[model samples]
Target: MRSLIVSCNVTVDGFMAGLGNDLASLDFIVPDSEQENALAARFREVADTIVFGRQTFLDMEAYWTKVDSDMAAWINATPKVVLSTDSGADVSIWNNTTLAAGDGAERVRRLKASEGGGLVMFGGVQTIRSMIAADLVDEYWLKISPVAVGQGSSMFADLPERRSLTLRGAKGYPSGMLDVTYAK
Candidate 1:
């Protein structure tokens, strides 16, 4: 079975988006070069499906589809499974996106067990946290951004249960980014 990976960027202070992330300064949807583009492409090659939280879906809707980069658009358009209560309109670029609710862990487990590639979480901090608390995340791709939001949104779920991830590897980017991969 393929692994469920929680991938996102965070700051040095352990905050994913400061505290609230209302400003959305932490998101790096804008990759400026071919190398970074290639790196993301490589990651996508291992990932067959991309799971998204409602808020993350909205955020993606606000930015990615409007983008001009074919590579970035292709990545965003990749199979996105959204877990949200909002009945928002779907973007044309996100054609394969589906809405899923209730028993997220079980659904994700089913997704992993079925025939496909690895599953990667796209922003959904709550979803990621819930899955993590449920011991669902098999891998993590944390791209640490240099900026700090001071008080924005958090990446991990505020669950009563906690889990640990084993650091696999980390590489620094020219834009002061550190991509860290972990496994549990």
Candidate 2:
């Protein structure tokens, strides 16, 4: 079976996005630091497949494809699966991308059962919520920045019940970002 991992940059207050579901709102966004970039590179090393929600897929395709960075290269070359309700979603704009519509949780479950390297998810809120609700996540790699947004959307907001996770590793960077990993 494959491992499904979620990588999120969250505020200290536990919000994934600020007002109006904007991650760029105010100083709520984590500052781009070398340590953070290094951490992301580490995450990229573990996952050969990237799982995304439709909006995130489009957003990333628009931005990453035009950039000239190692992350951009990895994203363009990696295989991606976007979960969306829109059957007409055009995934051809990006390389090695596929669209999976209907039963998000089941599709994720099926992916988890497939033979592959780690499956890592970036975001799109709704998709993360569904995966959390279905308990399909095997590991969570969270970079909790030192910022507090009093209110916003949370990945854990709609969880049906409390789920406990074991802290597998943690590292504190000078940028005040806590790079932590939790496993079920």
Candidate 3:
């Protein structure tokens, strides 16, 4: 079975998006370091498919489409599965994306059962919450930044029950950002 990993950039206060749903704070915290590059490469190697919520998929599609970097190329080339209820969603703008409509957990479970590399999920808050509530996430790779936003959306909110995670590893960068990996 392929593992489902929730990879996200989070603030010190545990918020994924700051006031007004801004993620600009994350840009200042990302280090131009070899460790970060290696981490990205590792995730790319492990996951053949990238999963997203509808909004995230659309956002990434708009942003990454014009970029020329390796990350952009990889993201554009890799298969993407967007979980959405909108039957009319036009995913054609993205080269390799498909929209999955129906039960979110059931679709994700079916994806996990399929023969392939690991699946990586980037969230739009509600999607992450639903996955957590359904106990569908196998691992979490959180890049904890130094800044804290007083008010914002939390990545771990609305969980049905307390979920314990075993710390697999942690890497700290010069920029004060910590890349922590946890296993369920």
Candidate 4:
């Protein structure tokens, strides 16, 4: 089965974005920089599909689609399997992108078990959390920001049972971010 990895950037205080949905304060990612460039290159090289959420679909199309580089467009154009209820919207952000409208966890499990490239589930919080709760996620690539958000939208939610994970690797970035990789 292909590994299901949930990759997200969260603050030290456990917030994924601010209370009002503002994420600009966590200023670590530079879109067109060497870091983002290399990340995108590797993401394309490894991940077969990108799991996204409704909000992610909107945000990505709004930002990444209009980005100033091919890497950005590549990121935008890559296969995105979004979990959305709105099956009647404009989702033609890229050729491979598609909306897979129901049973997020079950659908994801089927995708992971099927033959394909590595599966990467981008953290659109709610959707990712749902997968986590369903015990469908195989790995987690979490980027922990240095700053603290008193209270805001969190990356992970409390599931019914405690899921197990082992830290496979950890790296401290120059921008005060800690990149941690965990495997189940």
Predicted structure 1, TM vs. truth: 0.81
Worst 10 residues of 3 by lDDT: 24-33
Clashes by residue pair, model 4? none
In model 2, how large is the Cα lDDT of residue 39? 62
Superior by lDDT: candidate 1 or candidate 4: 4
Candidates' lDDT values, in order?
0.70, 0.83, 0.83, 0.73
Please, what are the lDDT tens digits per residue for candidate 3 over residues 1-184?
Answer: 9999998888788888766556654553565455557566877889999999888898888888997766677788899999988777778889888888877788999999999999999887888888888889999998888887677878776766787899999988887888899999
Clashing residue pairs in candidate 2, if any? none
The segments of candidate 1 whose C-alpha lies over 4 angstroms from its true place after superposition are 20-35, 85-93, 149-153, 156-163
Number of backbone collisions per candidate: 10, 0, 0, 0
lDDT of 1 by residue, 1-184 (tens): 9888887767665566544455366563334465456556866688878888777777777777777775566666678887655455453446688877657777788888889988888766667777877777888877677765456566563756565778898887777777788888
**Model 2, span 1-184: residue lDDT tens:** 8899998878888888776567565356556556556765875778888999988888878889898776677778889999988888888988899988888889889998888888999877778888988889899988888998689888888877788999999988777888889998
TM-score of each: 0.81, 0.91, 0.90, 0.84
Error of 1 at 115 (Å): 1.0
Over 13-132, each residue of candidate 4 has an lDDT whose tens digit, in order, gives 767776655656546442325445555676677787888887876777677767777567666666888887666755675667887877888889889889988888775777877888
- Clashing residue pairs in candidate 3 are none
Best TM-score goes to which candidate?
A: 2
